[model samples]
Target: MKRFQRIAGYLVAAALVGYFLWFASSNLDIRVLHELLTPPVIGTLIVAALAYAAIIPVTGWAWARLLAAQGESWPVSWLTAVLAVTQLAKYLPGNIAQHAGRAGLAMREGMAGKSVAITVLQETVLAVAASLIVGVSMLAASEPGLAQLPDGVRPVLAWVVPILLLSVLFLSTVHLSPARLATSPTRAMRLLGKAGGLPGARIALPALAAYAFNYLLIGSGLWLLARSAELPAALDLPLITAAFALSWLLGFLAPGAPAGLGVREGILIVLLAGVGSDGELLAFVLLARATTMLGDVINFLLGSLWLSLTRRIAR
Candidate 1:
């Protein structure tokens, strides 16, 4: 039964790829890919890959600091690996694998206290807050299909849940106080006190900047890829930014969509249909996905190799 389920998942993922490919055919040029992968061009690809790899550590450090803001410290290298692998594990069945990866890291490294859980929750809160704040700000500026709508247009009103959720999160964290926890979770409150001069909002502020910068880098890549593929210059920056942002956010939350392959392209397609020509939009999305995946592959290799070498040197 397990084997059968695994096979079914592969089929479903493959079907999604086939569907994506049909639309992305124009941008999946064999020659362009070869050019991009060549020895001469590989250097530029390496830089992109390294930038992507660096993002994991930077975000991990910011989050690790959030933990320290509660006067706790954990192994960041281990946490970074767990985060990276959790991202890769999202493609597995049910997304249980991904969550397991995160929870397992917490338990294995002696971070099984209530304080760790509190810190983890705080990190999740800050991340979502940052994502949606940028998202909402950009979504309002979306062009709303000027000249013509792309396809599968959902109502803007549907986004209220995520926006509201984000708003509530920001309010809660911004005014968070150790005194508010007097009646509950005393252990966690004590840890917060040990943070000394570091305030909770001080920790929260940096997560916002990190997430926004991460999105900005990825969005710029997508935008440039679109132009390279000859998409419209007059295209709305806000629309692209919002669409790309949602794609990343949803891809993270989505089950069994490792590296967010299916959800990423699928969401991009739907977003494009709302605002750009189907053919052109699909072309650029394909380019964006390829660039992103290629970078991921390189990052995984470099990180894996670096970890292996460091262990050997220590030995």
Candidate 2:
């Protein structure tokens, strides 16, 4: 049964990836592709890619803070590598493979398994919550009656409210008692299985700040890409930032939607309605995705190099 379930999951992931690739390719033309390959745009794309990669360190810092609360400390370089490499795993059938990879790496680096697990959970919750906080804040600040969310998106927003509340509750409660969390990964798991807790506080504020900054960095990248593409100057930076964050949040909430697949693109386009012609919008979305993939490659290479250097130093 377990094996069958695993196979099913892989099939679903492959299908989702296939669908998104088809959607993008169908909308792309040889001329459009060639146009994007121009030297100037390519340079801008590289810069945008680096901007996306920049979010990783902020992520590592947040995770590091969580681990530190458990009485374990791992180098930021190690955590970043673990995060960057494992990012590709989210494309696999099971969405949790990335989490498993991070847990394995953290344990290898001396963090208890349960500590790793708890931190991962907390990080996921906080990250989403931070995205929501940024998204909703921006939405509210916009001139009243500017635009209403799409009907389809309204349900997704509704569904996320309870999760956001629960995440806040978890964060507030977890730090109340951080003493003697656990000695070993196995012990940590056993303790969690019996009860349910793990730790953080002093760094908690900074961690959240880092997580929020990470979103802003991503949004900034989107803005850069928009500018490079000569997208509407009228769109404004804050609106673009909020739009991407909200679209991303919608994508993250979508189940079986590998990296938010069609869901994200759809939401983004809807949010940016009237910003440009349909052709231009499609081009921007494709460019954004291309730059994002480039960023992933950069992240993988940097993380691999850092990991190799650290290993050599240790040896």
Candidate 3:
């Protein structure tokens, strides 16, 4: 049954990617993509790519802080290095690979399997909550009328409310396992009554801050990419940030899409269509994705080399 389920997941992911490619090919002009490679645009893309590289460590720090909350504290540097290599797994076929790779690395460092599980879960919840909150706030600030319009406000609330609830629930659950308790089963079930009652488990303020910075870096990189494409100056920056965040969150939530491929581009094209002609919007989406990929490739190679050298020095 598990095998069947896995196969089904792969098929679904492939279908989603294929559909997006077909749509893109029909609407996108290849000539515009070639045009985007001019010297001025290339300079902007390099800047955007560097911003993306900065985001990797910021996100790793957030996850490391979450793990620290669970009593498996590691230096942010080590965790950042580990995550830099493992995060590339998201580009692979199965979504589980990234988490699984992280789990293996943590276990090798003597972290208990259950603790790793909880840490990953907590980090994901915190990250998503931070993303949604920042995204919605940007939208509201950019267009104050959104606050007055039920139609506009409802959709944002629909996502935000549940995410907020889930974050609270997860935060509560994090307290159940006392960090000092040596035994796993016993520690997992020992729930403290309330927030003030548990010292080890308050709120993850550092994690929230880290994720917020990470989101800002991501949005800024995309903004630079938009500028590289010579998008209209009339396009509002805050609105673009909100749109990117919303589209990114939606794409990440989608089942089976590797690193949110196809889904992210599709959503971006739709949201930014008003910024320019259909072909130009399509070019922006493609170039943004390409610039991001360039950053990822550069980081992955550098991170791998760093990790390898560190291991040799220890020996």
Best by lDDT: 2
How many residue-pair clashes does candidate 2 contain? 1
| Candidate 3 local Cα displacement, residue 169, angstroms | 12
Tell me the lDDT of model 3 at 81. 74
Report lDDT (Cα) of residue 124, candidate 2: 70
**Clashes in candidate 3: how many?**
0
Model 1: weakest 10-residue lDDT segment is: 145-154
Off by over 4 Å in 1: 1-51, 75-78, 102-107, 113-117, 142-199, 234-237, 252-256
> What order do you get sorting by TM-score, best first?
3, 2, 1
Q: How displaced is residue 48 in candidate 2, in Å?
A: 1.1
**Candidate 3: what lDDT?**
0.69
| Candidate 2 positional error at 37, Å | 3.0
- Please state the error at residue 179 of candidate 3 in Å: 8.2
TM-score of each predicted structure versus truth: 0.67, 0.77, 0.79
How much does candidate 2 score in TM-score? Answer: 0.77
After TM-score superposition, the amount by which residue 225's alpha carbon in candidate 2 deviates from its true location, in angstroms, is: 1.5
Clashing pairs in 2: 113-185
In the range 1-315, model 3's lDDT, one tens digit per residue, is 977876775665566577668768787776777788898888888888888778778877776766665567777777777777776788887577878887898789788886677667667766776777677766665653243345866577667656765665465445443533433454333432211122233546667667767777867877777776787653456666766777777666655776888877776765555556777767777777877787877777877887888789889
Candidate with better TM-score, 2 vs 3:
3
lDDT values for all models: 0.60, 0.70, 0.69
